[model samples]
Target chain A: MKLLRNLVLAAVAVGGISAAYAAGAASFPHNLVSGIDAAGWDLSVRKADYDDDEHEGYRRFGGGHERHHEDDDDDQGRNYGQNGPGPAGSTTPPDNGLILKGTAPKVQVN
Target chain B: MKSFLAVLAVTTALSAVTPAIAGEVTLTTNLRNYGGPGAYLAYYVTDASGKYLGSLWMSGGKARYYEHLTGWYRATGGNLGEIAGITGASVGSGRTLEVTLDLADALFDAGYELHIDAAVEDYRDSPNEIVVPLTSDGSGQPVQGSRYIADFTYTR
Candidate 1:
C-alpha cells in the first residue's frame, strides 16, 4: 500500500510540473504571440472595438464616424487602363501561344 | 512505289505539325444607353454541362470591379491571368464592341455555350446577360440581353 501511494505521488508531481511548465511557456511573449496567431486573431477585432468606442464618442459629438472604411477603400475609383482614341482600346491581344488560323485576335469599339 | 513512299513521308511530316482547325469568329456586343458609367463585360465559354472552358475577352481593365461580374468571378475567382492580354477598356453606353478571334472549330456545332456578364459602376450587375449556344447555324443570330446589352451576335 505504501509503494502504491509513492507511485501515485510521483505521477501527481510529474503532472504538476508539466502544468507549471505550460503556464510559464504561455506567459512568454513569443509563445503568446504565436498562440494569438494560431487562434486566427486579426486586427479587425481590435478595430471593431475601437470603432465602437469612436462611434459612441461620435454620438455624443456632432461628428459622424465612417464605419465602412473597407468599403470606402474599394470605391476609390482607380482606373488601370487608358481610354485612347484608337480603333480599339490601348491594350492589344497578347501572344498567349494560342494557335490561330490567320491574324491575331483584334478588338474594335465603335 | 518510290513516289508513293515520298508522298507518304511528306504527308506524315505535314500532319505531325498541323494545328487544330481554327476559324475567325467575330463577336459583336451593342450596349443600351443606360446613362451610367462605362460597362465592363466578360465573355467566357462553357461546356454543355456549364463547366467553364476559358475566357475569350474581358472588356474592362480594372480588376477591382471584376467582382461585379458575378458569373465570371464565380467561374474564375477573378484570376487576372485568365484575361491578362485580352483585356480592354470598358465600353461606353450605346457603344458597339466587336472582337474577332480565331477559335477552334471544335467549339462550334458542339454542346458549348458563350456567356457574357455585364456590370456598370454604381449600377446593377448582370450575370449571364446573354447566353447563346455556339453553333454554326447560330451564327449571325442576334441574341437579346437582360440588363445592359441591347443585342449580341456571333458571326463566323
Candidate 2:
C-alpha cells in the first residue's frame, strides 16, 4: 500500500511539472481570430422567428443570402395598442442593473 | 329563488348608479438570463380570499404557447378573449416588461392578489411565478419570481 501511495504521489508531481511546461497555449476563444462573438447579441438576426424546422423556406437562386428578403412579416408584437382598450403606453422601466436578454411578443387578446 | 332575484335586482341597480372606481395600475417584470426564447407570461388577479378575479395581461401572441403556462391555462381555459387588448409581446431573457392599465380601485388593499404564470419554450412551466398581495403597501416593492421572472413590481 505504501509503495502504491508513493507511485501516485510521483505521478501527480510529474503531471504538475508537465502542465507548467505547457504554459501559454495560445488563448483560443478569447482571441478574435477564432470566430465571431458567440454571444450573438449584435448579430443582425431575423426580426420574426420562423418555424424553419423542415428547411422549406428556401429563397430564390439569386441573392439568396441577404437577410432583408427573408421575411416581410413585421414584428406584429409591437402593434398591441391598435387592437384593444386604447393605447397603453409604456412607462420608464426601472434600472434593475441586470443584463437584458430575451423578449417575447404579447399574447393577442383578439 | 326569490332571494336570488331580489339580490340580482339590487346589485344591478347599485352597479348602474356607482361605476367601478379604477386607476392606472402598472406591472413591471424583470427576467433572468436563462438563455432561451422569449417567455410567455399570464398575469391575473385574485380576490383577497384567493378567488380568481380576472386576467390582466398576457405576453405572447401565440396560443400554442399558452398551454405551457399550465396554471393560467387551467384557470382561464386558455381563453383568448380574457386577455384581449391587455396582451403584449413576450419578454426576452434578462430583460424587463412594463405593463400599465386602468385597474379597479377595489383591487388595492382589498384582499386581492396579483398572480403571474409563465412558460418558456423548451423550459420548465412556471405556474404562479409571482403571487403578490394587492395591498397599497405592496406597490413599488419588488417580489422575486419562481422561474423565468427574476423580479416583479407594481405601481399606481
Candidate number with greatest TM-score = 1
Q: Candidate 2 at residue A97, lDDT?
A: 14
* CA RMSD per model (angstroms): 17.9, 20.3
Q: Which candidate wins on DockQ?
A: 1
In the range B64-107, model 1's lDDT, one tens digit per residue, is: 66777889999998877667556677888888999988878888
DockQ of each: 0.10, 0.03
Q: Residue B50 in candidate 2 has what lDDT?
A: 65
Off by over 4 Å in 1: A1-78, A81-103, B1-20
Candidate 2, residue A34: lDDT: 31
The superposed Cα distance between candidate 1 and the true structure at residue A21, in angstroms, equals 74
Question: Each prediction's Cα lDDT score?
Answer: 0.74, 0.65
Model 2: CA > 4 A from native: A1-110, B1-20
